[model samples]
Target: MSKSSFQGTTRRGFLAGTAALIGAPAFATQPLPVQEVEVSQGYDPLRPPPVPEPPVRHNISSFQAKHWQPYFSNLHNGAILVDTQSRALHFWSEDYESHMLFPSSVPLSDEMTRRGRTSVVRKVKGPSWSPTPSMKKRNPEWPDYIPPGPDNPLGTHALYLGWKYYRIHGTHDTRKIGRRSSNGCIGLYNEHIAKLFERAKVGTQVLLI
Candidate 1:
């Protein structure tokens, strides 16, 4: 659940304090966007840093990431590793690798190369894409909101990440799998995203590493 924080100071105090003297907000007030972030990618099990800083179209000066953890997310066993830098998502154990390994998927079209790559974070069931204002501006053809369903850009399942506007989610465009595509969202096989979406939870740590 979310909380609220407040500083018991007034604008008068704000003007009186030095630039650095501003009071810190109360910690108890609101839920931190990343209440708990841990290293999940095998790259550095002890500590995983943010992944390749992917680029986007029609960028924004700032994005609102009030970041409320969803009711469910793509929470994974720490042993599983996901590297956004390599664009590969891996699952491993103490001894060996899982039979299935997800290689870095990049789009082949020039349209895809326009932006960089990203990682998979949380997964959602029947996700609905509430296209951002920028998304609508870029793709005027886009819908105001994509209702949760099979045909949605978010597909039957979605693996959301902490990117500006990117997510490695399920796609109705199955043919785009294993290739560079999408405005920014990573495309996964519908079946795969669906299966994985069932296993995650909100607050699960997601590493772009």
Candidate 2:
């Protein structure tokens, strides 16, 4: 057969068939078997599965994953409260249960992309931090992986946000916390930040005053 004729049969035939099937009487074809759906915590098979959403990137660090165990290390258990004017962060025990992690104040900064100076920008679990252009230039010798241990420059754990590429994190540089001494990042004692890392969650309301 000629190419044109052949194309018509294949393409048109398929479309015709589709329309017929779709337009046929609802019961013209054999009835489909019906099954009941079982419910589960996070998934459902009976109904169409939900469309997945793209994941958001947090700028914390792998250093957060390994170094600190803040899951249960707070006076209030991993809740962050920041006083922007004072430049301090507080990690209190969560409301449900209780144990103070650290009540001592640590200076903070509003080096983020927010409109005005503020603290407690946002909270996330093990946030991810990508270095700023200037940071990479300054620390050209910085390593590929900020490793999951204490000595990592991201410190023991890191909560990174815009404020001039500043991160609220642990540091072997404990001396820097209550001071405005980061490349615009917040510096906490290596041990202290670790505690914050353990207790904080991805969306634990970060109150900034």
Q: Pick the candidate with the highest TM-score.
A: 1
Return the lDDT, model 1, position 154.
Answer: 64
Per-residue C-alpha lDDT of model 1 across residues 1-209, encoded as one tens digit per residue: 11111111223432343122223332122322322111111221111222333322211111111111231133234222343333444332222212122323343334433342233456567787777675677667656775776447666776676565666676654334333445555554555555445444433344433
TM-score of each predicted structure versus truth: 0.47, 0.42
Please write out the lDDT profile of model 2 over residues 68-186, one tens digit for every residue: 12322432323555544444454444543332222122332344423323333444434444456765676665543444443444554666543545456655433343334445455
- The top-ranked prediction according to lDDT is 1
Where is the poorest 10-residue window by lDDT in model 1? 58-67
Candidate 2 similarity to native, TM-score? 0.42
lDDT (CA) per prediction: 0.40, 0.39
